[model samples]
Target: IGSRFSADTFRIRDFFAMNRVNFTWIDIESDPQVDELLKQLQISEGDTPVVAFGNEWIRRNPTNRELAERLGILSTLKEEVYDLAIVGAGPAGLAAAVYGASEGLSTVVLDRKAPGGQAGTSSNIENYPGFPMGLSGRELAGRMTLQAQKFGAQLSTPREVVKLEFENGYPVLYLDHDKCVSAKCLLIATGASYRRLNAEGREQFEGVGVYYDATPIEAELCGGSLVVVVGGANSAGQATVFLAEHARKVLLLLRGDDWGKDMSRYLSRRIEQTKNIELLTNTEITRMTGNGHLETIEIRNNRTGETRMVETRAVFTFIGAVPHTEWLPEGIETDEKGFIKTGSTVMNSPLWTAQRRPHFLETSRSGVFAAGDVRAGSMKRVASAVGEGAMAVAFVHEYLKEM
Candidate 1:
């Protein structure tokens, strides 16, 4: 018998344990005698491993990759139209979907790429609550997606929203190639994008040797090789710590003298104790050189006017992120940095003050709301995003009721 829970089976465990193989194991072995019993029953060949699900032969020595593809577990088709249309399938959007659908509102979530915005790119998130052991950003996003879908939230991936407009007091969302979707309400959960270095050859070597976010796919390319990470904030510090675990050496290049003071103290201490990491202050990448892939990065020391070349297989940058709101209408109130602005009062609150007024998460344009990293004054965290998303929905209800 085969199980789809544990990885105690030697063959299946070894196949996934090898980093070279890009496959995930989902099952475990039940009993050695079961294999022989199946052969005796003329159901399977005794020479190879076999799986039986209720007297039916499901597989024979099948690799996990093959099983995943055959079972349609890799990808599935998505439906269109929803009562509540959510743009950006990150944490905020997923949270809203769960609450909206569970509350009997038809919800639809769309994303330009895979779910889990900037937070998904993280290798491990230790600060999130409820998990003392810590969890990967990918895992957290996956759980949220499952929870949302369980409550009837529809998800559409690899779809981009091109424009947003209002028709008869209802918000209409437009996708690439003029695909339009009208909804009772719209939530701008479209998170932010990382700012690129714009160095020569940086574009050409994007997937081959350069990456904006440190993920498992990018980390695998740095096996036993030197890696360069550029940034000074929490993201940079996190990347340096994550890369240092797999790479032979990690060079952290900061534009200033010290790590961003806002970085968590525990993370700062870990980076200091890690012997494999090298800290370079007041430095910047001047250029990059490679034919098909990146071989060496040229750095400029701002203080000494000196240049140095660091040979490495891969470079990960986490400098900062830019909000994705260019398509939004100009009438919508936003901060100087382009983040959506909300009123300084809680929705449906009876208390009001002239100076210390309550602000709801309503965007400059009435009836439109912003949440998560896309909203101004938002605390960039998974838990915080969920809270903001739920609160925004309450405001949306109030906005519609008054209108």
Candidate 2:
């Protein structure tokens, strides 16, 4: 009964579903047993989201780290050091951990949030290999996490690595909460985040009508309202398809002339075939207007120079990706767009004074590497990220031998 109005319930449900956490929801409005239990726990009907894990019961929705701690998966790092430290739990980091631990190296993988990164939030990954039927991004990431841990790689979540520096010959990282750790080698595989719209009033409607991701958490908030999805990539197409299930109408705004130019053939066909999905090419959002929540958006046609306002509460963007390299040290060279420089490309850097050229996927800093979307000139695909991560482990072995 309260599901429609409660964003917290949808968030909790979506997070659990994505992480593959086994848990049940009790409405308490219908079940007498659950109602009585809620009464016992002093959780009234107004408090709809009372999550229980093991012996602990949280009155409010739990964050990802809190859930991990309750489930006994978040490991305590303490003062323990490692042979290799990965600063992201996306595909690249997970692959490195799986390979690093299986090859007898002590590895620790840390992520600021949950393990899946951006790819984990996807509803269905049809293009990824071995999954013809298209399993969820969460399932793939959860399986990889388990495989990494199965080989003895330690994972710590919701832990942010604020800064990195070189201490002696090893790399040292300072994380949030005054925690310091060191590793012989480091991998900056934080990947990329969803780029935000540069239109006016875009910030005011965030979390209200505009969202970067169209996962169920955001979809549930739209509540059959007319939705507008920006960008023409596969991620935007996926969001459009997923949002169409709940949104009354889905409008895809493409700044380019051809819809299929950036999107996958399959997704383009699906968007073209969908009845409720409207495709507007050479379009761009000029402004967003609302009292507190986004009520309308003004769009411009780049080709025709015509402008019009549309009624839409939800706007999802899946445009270009910007790498997460701000926290990286100065020695680790990055492109103008902040993607880490790797392989022979590092040879162009003045920092590359070593006798041997940098190994493929190795960053400008010796013993430091990069892969996935975070690496400069990398192919933005899950398979390529996995391949680079596994390949980086081989170079790690060679670097260690020289050490």
Candidate 3:
């Protein structure tokens, strides 16, 4: 029938659902046409979320960008050389690609998952500049991706960078599945990821009912049902407001008593104003239980030694984020928390031995730059990341001159 155990399936569905892409979902077990279609496609039992395009069927789950490539909507990575290569598709990397290409540089952007990075997952982003009425994270990211592509920047998604190797002055980035791409200058803007709640049964019910964002898919499924949201950040606050429109009631759990401590003033006020969103301060989710999907959650009061259970099928976590810099080698300088160190900050390190000083946003390794949330001491905002991405391209030009 329908299965949510596979991560790839969830990713494809999430991408399509968030973008409001129209498609018919056929459950194999429930629908009679599945058996005949499966036979026609010659798909095995394990092959799920099989995509049928024209007279062919792709018997595997694919990311949004991968799906686009398969449908001929996105061009493949045909060129071998690029003036600048960006290793992420977030605001920072996308900005760099846009400016780099518009300025007549051959640019190639690679992302392991999809465009927009962490900021692309939000249901609403009100603080980003230029949009007075606010916009969904998906919409904002989509527009940025389009703009970058329109400027002649080529983007390849679901493409992971396995390692970085230097030859002469070129930074050659190796991709997964033994693929590789080389560029005169490189930028690391991989950004960060959400930290999952470490409660019991967390993995068992991950996609079934537990989630990291409050996208429209969850809102549609959890309608008239009780829902729980953990964390006090703006992302958490946004999810609460969005879920309030569909869920019968939303339980906003916070480890600390003051929600305003970690969240923005505007989001705090909006959460306070929403009647259906109930705030549960000094509480944390300790356990989760369900048959196949989440049915209830066990919570504990951090301040008081009291424990209780709450009935809910859906729980969204928007806690702290951890940078994605583990793939980087030791030569690249990083902070205690693994964020990249750049510019004058790298000059103090023993690894920096170049005659000239490092440029702003330039990493310890010459001709390399870090931007967005991946850089140490960076502002965690979409606008700031975009600015950094665009600025990094300028530094690339400067470094190319010296080479």
Q: Best candidate per TM-score, number? A: 3
lDDT of 1 by residue, 309-350 (tens): 889868888876689999887656667787877676332233
Per-residue alpha-carbon lDDT of candidate 2 for residues 62-112, written as tens digits (9 for 90 to 100)? 666677777776678857568899999889999999999999999999998
By TM-score, how accurate is candidate 3? 0.91
Off by over 4 Å in 3: 1-8, 17-21, 26-48, 58-69, 73-75
lDDT of 3 by residue, 275-315 (tens): 99999999999999988678889999988879999999889
lDDT of 1: 0.71
Higher-scoring candidate on TM-score, 1 or 2: 2
Q: Score every model by TM-score.
A: 0.77, 0.88, 0.91
Question: Against the hidden true structure, what lDDT does model 2 obtain?
Answer: 0.83
Question: Candidate 1: how many backbone clashes?
Answer: 6
Residue 402, model 1, lDDT = 58
Ranking by lDDT: 3, 2, 1
